[model samples]
Target: MTRKRPLKQAFALLVVLSIFMVGFRLIPFDEPRISLGNYTIEDGFQLRVIASESLLKAPVSMDFDDKGRMWVVEMIGYMPNLEGIGEEEPTGKISILEDADKDGVADHAKVFLDKLVLPRGVAHVYGGLLYIDGPKLWFVEIKNDRPGKKTLVDPVYAEGGNVEHSSNGLMMNIDNWIYNANYNFRYQLKNGKWLKEPTSARGQWGITKDNFGRLYYNNNSTNLQGDYVLPNKIIRNKYFKPSIAENKRLGANRVYPIHQTSVNRGYQSGVLDEKGFLKDVTAACGPLVYRGGIFPESYNQNAFVCVPEANLIKRNVLHYKGLQITASQAIEGKEFIASTDEGFRPVNLFNGPDGAMYVVDMHRGIIQHKAYISQYLTEQLAGKKLDTLQNAGRILKVTSKTIKPNPIPDLSKASSSQLVALLSHSNGWLRDRAQQLLIQKKDRSVIHQLIKLTSLTNSFSTAIHALYVLDGLNALSFESLSALVNQSKNPETIAHAVGLLERFSARQHVAKMKAISTQLLAQNNETIDLYLSMSLSPWLNLSEATFLPVLSEIEKKHASQGIFQEAITSGLGGKEEVYLTSMNPTDLLKKDLTTAITNRQKKELNPIFVLEKNSVDNRTKGLKLFRSICATCHGADGKGIQDLAPPLKGSEYIDGSMKRLASIILHGVSGPIHVNGKLYQLNNEMPALINNKEISDQDIADIIRFTQNAFAKAGKGISADDVKKMRDKKPSGSGIFTEKQLLESDFEK
Candidate 1:
């Protein structure tokens, strides 16, 4: 090859880039411009284009203000100058669109800010617009009919790398916390003081919440990853990540990633097969939990996602088992919305003002960027003639055909009490706006009324929102907390109360939480117990002696029951060890519960039966014992009978923490309980089996071995020595063992 000059090569590249940009700008958007008529949707719904074409270029995300003005984020630089340039080119813009004359479609549009490079997330905050423009976040101060003054906000996601998958789904939740998925930073801005907390990265993209204030998150390839036990517990614990422990199973192929659709070329493309499916998800993005009004009541709080690779929006029915999530398809044989148009790419989804879900379609011909472009994908695009429909894009709302959308709220001038009333509104947008304004105004004037709303309102969501607003204003007093725990039975609300008490750490407040926790624990409320443990885990800050009663009650159950058994047992190593350790509890904690239990066992169990060679076939003998003893309560198969007995099958206690399970069998159990997410009253308490004579250690081991083999399919059989080691601690004199005691046995160790 003739050696080309370095300068000449550089010139050729620039010329090619210039031609590509020119072609992108000149590409025709079909005449009569694409509208709602261009697409088809599911039954019981109609698609209406709110804004299109010139008003929106490559719109990816959107949000609305109190005035119902729609703010749309457009990534014009997406796919990088139509695949001929670098990724970070500062080509993103925020468009403010409005139907000034009250028409349904947007008739007025203005470029609020046009300097953003790959701006991905947008939300209405404090009467202004907050958006993520790369790694840095920005806020634009807006006054109607004028250009907004954009200011550098928090230094959240420093804004580099692949723009396609970055932090997104910016939102303020019921707890008055702002979060973005794929990022660990959480924000709580109170009167200009940003209280930042490092949290778990929810997922790769979308974020949402249910009526109970539990957050749910999603990413592009992963299905779903939240249903947090509390509003923001994961943030405090630092245990969540992009690859969360819990996930919703969407029918997706499990590959690394599908699209290197931006100039950031870190992802692979040859990973895809000939048929071109995204493996597990074609791209599960923009997850929304419908908390809107326009849809039928049946659709409320149901999750919807944009599976772009499949050219469809899917509806998922979410089932929560305690803290875990189980999602099933709400619509069978079809998605919530799908289209034949090859360029129909539903990139992001949101539930907006009029109680309708809006889908943002990038509407591009060549979506996959040039850097990682592969031969197979190139051929696939050529076959579909989907190379460059560059200028077309849309924001369309999907709503019921018969039910008219509620008129948007006009809270720009509402009084404090009026805003408080809006907290109970059916629309998530309205509730969020109401809380945002209340925080901004910080009107101490409504504190009393807000307190009343929290206590008197029938709507649990409203009650919780009211308390959150009170907290925002620093107006949450001891009285407000007293009302929250007393007025609501909802676990999420109780969790928030426990969290607040923990943060404040007042002796009186901790005492109050302990009191409430005592009652809730009696009912086997897992949410409250979990929250209480999280609050108390910091140090021996609050004297471990204070919770002795609650601790003593749960000691027999599971350690997860909020009774820290290892801490308790190690403390019991003797009065001197306890006295020495009060000043340095972390040191005492080093003495594992197993060692403590072993020490205590030699002193506790009377007439322990050493296993004999002729002790009987465990499965056969254990089954006979189970039929005569446990069958009445735990059922024939250990699946549990009803309110009277709890199931042993499928319990984490059975397959997990073998020591905990063996202890419960040896000592018997009492108090309220949680088994596989269901709560039981235990009206007929599980009778203690080890009367020192009726059930021997060998018999106990055999029974458990049989129960494990019969009920827990994934169980490893319990050995005779395992039962005696757990039996070292004597049973309580009367009543039954609590969940905490079983967990304290250190079986999970």
Candidate 2:
């Protein structure tokens, strides 16, 4: 429904309170205030104030509707109080803005959804705007190009634990999966059922994928990270262990500092250090992998990450070695879009219709949260403040000479065939919207043609879109999926097909699916093999030999890999040659193809992809070792068993150099133990977990690194040499070292 609230509603909520919810209050005002930012750009680019600070206030996110008009989310009341509380009031708004004159600036604006609470993320999808407002996730349907009634689709449980780090970015991937940041459990209504993929913990606040479906994201801190190697084959993330490592800072190759800006609040960024050395990236948001038609072809898949604290957008060029992933700077010294407007806070980035980059500028006095407020920020805000412009925001468009956006398409009443053609459109969003609309229509008349597009289309992405559309409509068949698998050369197709095809497994299409899995067995994707084994084994009458390949791959994968080990513990059964359940792989199968797969995996994959892949094998081996040995004492969760062993978490002693840390694992701890400022004495003394003959140096290193990844909260991983040094310096023994003996060593100091 349309909100008829007057403009005063945006300005009237400035009253101050003593609560710690709001960090800043709106300045006393009687009239609307606007602060049109100085839109400046570097060479080869043109900047436009699409909707200046006048029309859009606190525009944190935006997406184009079918008609091409932009729908914007205004967090008008966010951060005004101590808590940034939007507690049951019209503190935020979703508005529709139109560039009716075909000019850069929007001439009209109207309230779409009023009275929102910290509404951080939104996208034009399915039928309306999908948004996350802290605890509630909603869909506000658009009818006849206007906002209709809203329905609560799910609850975003990001109400606590740093709301800024909560589920924020809502993006629809090319494969038809709408992913979110941080929120592990999400609901999507599909085929009259709620399909859910819930993880254990949380991840970043912004998420985007490259052309091949490799995800890229960042938190309020951690810069750029996601699949360096081909990720696990099945659904693996049960929890998001936050990367607090100051050293594990991974980003573009080029190391550039914050660009020109005036409102210099924020502490020295985590992406760089005191000596101008790169440390990590903090406040990294709006992760965008450029996939539009208008820009230069050379910039096709370049990743643009917004560093609002730096007042710049970084351009990261993607490079692949063997299969290892690397993102280096596109430029040497400058940012993609550096501005002097310190108040120009870009919270989100979008690849728009005109083949241009859209920046959502929350032009306010403060961007950092109260809890994370640094001393530098407090002093800066005190001097260089935008107190009068607390409700100001802008949507900026960046384009080049070769790019131009077309008029918006009115697809609400488009024909089935008309919608089908968009499957091959150059713009990914167009293809996604078309597929969504066709599925929503659910007309059997278009089924044959939709199936035809999947076969006839030459573009792999277009074909995949058609495949998922059919799946979304719950009309995908074994034949259609089989055709996709047979025709497409991209391994990603096989992976996507497996996900879509598994929906039929519940219907007991065992043989049809078994044939498909039998073919995929030859194609050695760990994730694909894992999925096929799990899906087909429970239904098909396949022999244990069928899963041997997957089981071998699982055996070689890192311990932090997947549900395989857990499956082996819970469902697997066998006397000598064991398997997960009906389809678990045999031990003999691991031996037969173990060395062969490892050899082929190194050479056949990209030349640069070997190291990262090998590390996975090493880590997995260590996990197996850890379970058989260390898990008995440190406990599976690493919190440690009561009295039996002290907690491994928050152990400052463990944070010392690798030599000392490795010595503890190799020789074991003894006497009184103080970790994270607490003392504990176990009943039994520590014992050496490793036997030098059985465990390799790489195995010990991988185990230590895995623990560091899990319990130590470290980014800098140790090498085998680091572990080797500990063994060489202090030979392993059954006797435990006293607390003073471990601490007094000058090795770490």
Candidate 3:
């Protein structure tokens, strides 16, 4: 009996040990959900409605006041009478909603402001709310219990002094001065008005102010701008990689705009006057040139910094007050939440009450889908119990309480052993956080620790997080990544490690990425799934030029996968002209140009050209047409880039249908349209493209076909019959087309 009892105890112990070992895979490894203890999570987190909500019909941007009340900007036309208000452009008005009970749902909802003239960007300055209405800068001050709006700048001045009235992005510095991004408006704003400020770059939707008062705007281009004073001193480096710049380019893939950081002094300037109020245009960063880069290695100080898309949430060094200022990775990471939020399109970073940054994604998408808004509001109002990932597009609170970022350890004073001990801590967050801090502190002595962390199989996930830290730290080296890949046995871990490598110049990591990819492919382990090939193409490997044929075949085979297909198509779409032997890059570039030119043309012309010819023809005629007609609204190259004018090329709408096209040109699209899968509001008043009785139906049809085939290859070879059908049975001018409506249209076929 004693011997049997001992055997049973041994068997029970083995069973318990087996169960515990299997539980590691089930551990909740998601980013920690922490609470500040004082301001509950409900205080900041907002509910989003991307999938439902009818009244919120195309919510684009949102703004908040000192009282914490929110004003949502809806893209669809307003229901003034709620009985029969005809749909019209400038479908403009503002909704004021309040959550007095601390619930995410609004306790009170009504139209707070109305009759806005195509308002795009909104911000708060001093005690009033500011909005960009056409060429005028207007503000409404809240007094007693009512709101009153006043024009801060004259419409004529803003229009005549500048290129156009539309403004896409806006921001207010801590000192209270406002900066506006005039979708392709590279002009100057002087004395409460705008003027021609010529530059090679076009401004897109992002504008932010750094602590030093430098205003950074996302210039929608890869072509570097030439120096104003020293015209010949043009920097060859691309500041904003076009593939990553502007919402339209990236929106197609469901990715937001490139995250960028800039100083306020770069574009406009402000200072606290004697009255302690903010004033505009005090100084520019032009004269404050630094020789090195933005951080430790190169601090080249020049006026008007152009931030690339990759550095968003990545650590960057900026020159402020003649001192190289260091911004922590946490500051950059805040944008991830703001970027993910749907309501906050055209988001601008603002200092919140908690002394941290809060971004209000313009309520463009929110207003478009009211059902989603209702459900989202319901979930949010319910204390965020419905913590679904789809609600990423909400009002994100970046208070210090949300993210308990580790304090930066002064590695300069710490011993190597201490550094390793900190990095190898049992807490994964602590260990990863320490590795990031060490990279930033940049003490080479810690290299041994980094190398050791790379080799430890238990630290594979820890090492992946550390690589992103290295990327922000600018400590990523080809040799280092190669060493890590050699030791890595886990496929998922290695996939993340490969993703970081894609950020560097393609030429630099090609060899290492190729070798790692080759090794990953050979692994037959069922648990070893590789997502890295999604970012890989045959062209990535530089050293093995002889293996190009094999790689090309491999790329062709993998191109069928969703991720890989998207990556390759997006990459090709980004190029000005990409040439593959099987299919010429020139042909694709020409097709894009023809699509761009015809989409902008008042009347379609069959220019007897292929992609190569169209590219040449567009360089001449396209620029003129763009400036005279399209530039005033959509901007050159059909980015529909204005705060008011809708983007045409790459526009999901223009890629199909002649009905919406005819309405926009003849009657005009009044509200928001989902283009590139992101909703955009043209704000009504597009100055009717046709004098209804003048243009012939045939001409319109030709124009329709040309535009349909211009931007996306999927839209090629559309027929005029399609145009006639759209023009005949189009929706009444009651509201802009809905995503459901567009999807339901026969044109989708």
Candidate 4:
């Protein structure tokens, strides 16, 4: 009986232990078990996790609302596993994270929206939430943290492309226009109407702006690229593509990762240094020009770029010389923030309302999209078990150690007068938000205050913001703008005033504009000169005799400068020939300008597929496919990006045999191939479209036809039958062809 009692007791203890173990596994731990010790930030700056898993999962981008709550876009379905099998599942969400207990860390998370496929961007604008859900940009009013009155802002906002190459960044600039990266159009909701206009297509992943409103963005390889001039300023002429202003690579690609990085192209020579650290930026994105005031004054205007593949954030010190903006590494061989943990993937950066920098860390193992993932990276990910890290993210706040981040103000409840006063706040984010709120309120009572603020000489950024605010409010007049132009000593303020004066460039305003132009031209200030040159076009359209002399004087003085010349040419627009005829024929600068303008005009006139009806139909279909798919890598103009793809505009491959081109397209080509005599050793393998079940034989044919017609200038195109034949002839094994193999194969059939 005693032996039997001992056995019963043992069995009871085992049963209890089993139940507890099962309960422990079933109990949900919203907070992920991640260690903060994994991070290593630069001295004088501290980084702490403010929001993490359970609160926000796979946060790619985040925007703070007027209540100072974070509206986070979680791309949860991205790269779910090594094969990305369930990535199409609509499991993504936008969660509103709040610090409920008044603690710095987010204690509660309420989902504002869910069932998103891959929502990339979000912004609090127009008293509503603007967010990107896959290809569409949507707006929804928030009532009690729930979406209401949903409206589709743009159905094809991003169109077809992988998340990495699709349009994102719903950033509202100081000009009251909402801009995006990887998109050609800017959006605005004016007087309860949605307005979109074509602008320059910018960077790949993320976009930001400086204090002066010049945008900054980056791509996979380049560290930083920015517009020298303000948005839509230089793209005035449909024919001219300004080289000096838009999409200028302002920083070098050199990178210094603290630890050995698991880059996609690590197998390629020169991708990693001798010490095994990434040699350069391979996946640079989310460039943020630091306008947060909490950082040391030296850190002001510093550009912080996210290199997720390297698990680091690079700091770049930007130097402004007149209109040109350039950047250099803050430290020669170090990073601002680095982590030993491979899952510390910082994908986007934002200046917080609290005057600190917030990093949106998609704390996942695989940062690269499956479409561009390399076999070497696949092996690396598998070897390290990085594919197992999923559904986890962190929003890290970076603040100076000596100076605490300011408490986030509830701008939603702030009065109109208070919002107006905030225009001069040291933090650019607050200043921008204040301007946006003021415009949204449509409070005409503050217009006088804003106009007065524009004339303040002490705060140039404030003045600029105030000027744009007045413009946004539709309160700016010729008298007000001219006053700023005449009274303002700050070149940037005067430059903006000059840009604003274009609205008043009628015959009545021309004489006054010419007088202002003549007076400003005498100063020879490059910034003032550039804006004056760009703005004079409207006046010139009305009275060429009055503005022509003004242009000629500015042109002769600044003829050697390309930016100035470009601006002058931009202003001339339809009067290019007139200006060229007036200039000296012997002038080399004039000859160069004439050549550029003439070539651009010719290219515009000689657009692809002005042929027969059938060819035109094929060309049209092909062009749509090319823009949606091929343009992601080859670029819209077919001039490929560095370390991304070789230029297809004049590629020997495109101009060569149709069969060869078809084969290459069906089964992708690996590079170290020569395009226009320049060797391009691209890191990512050109993916095979044969496996993409969505792309049909006809689609492939159209793409080929488009590439040949548009880029190669070939009159002929292949048929779906030809594409099928090439698909059938695809070589055995992995099916991805190397440059050597493609060159050696006989495609004569």
Best by TM-score: 4
**Model 1 residue 483 CA deviation in Å:** 3.7
2 versus 4: better lDDT goes to: 4
Please report how far candidate 3 places residue 714 from its true position, in Å: 6.1
Tens-place lDDT digits, model 4, residues 21-42: 6542111223334567978889
The ten-residue window of minimal lDDT in model 1 covers 605-614
Clashes of 3: 71
lDDT of each: 0.63, 0.60, 0.38, 0.81
* Cα-based RMSD of candidate 4: 11.5
**Which of the two, 1 or 4, has more TM-score?**
4
Scanning candidate 3 in windows of ten residues, the lowest lDDT window is 227-236
* Per-residue alpha-carbon lDDT of candidate 1 for residues 1-749, written as tens digits (9 for 90 to 100): 88666874455445445545654221212222354554556678898777778767888888887777778899877764332243467878888776643557765566777778878889887767778776778776776534467667666464432454456777888777887776656676566655666554466667887777666777655655564454444322221121222234533323322332221112245434454433345456778888886788777778887766656677877776765567776755556776656667787878777788888988876665432233345445655556556766788878899888888777787888899888878887777778879988879988878877765544337777877887888876665576677666676677677666555656655676566666767767756655554455422246557654454454444444212333244223333244334423333233433344444455532111111111234555665577678777776645687777887766877768666777777777886887888877877667766566877777777677666655564446667777877766655565357866555555544
TM-score of each: 0.66, 0.65, 0.32, 0.80
Give residue 77's error in model 4 in angstroms: 1.1
Encode model 2's per-residue lDDT on 649-734: one tens digit a residue.
67775556777777777777775788788888778887864566777778788777656544554433678877776765553354
Of candidate 4, the 10-residue stretch with the lowest lDDT total is 605-614
Looking at model 3, residue 18 earns an lDDT score of 55
Candidate 1: regions farther than 4 A off:
1-38, 80-87, 145-150, 234-280, 369-373, 456-460, 508-511, 538-540, 548-749
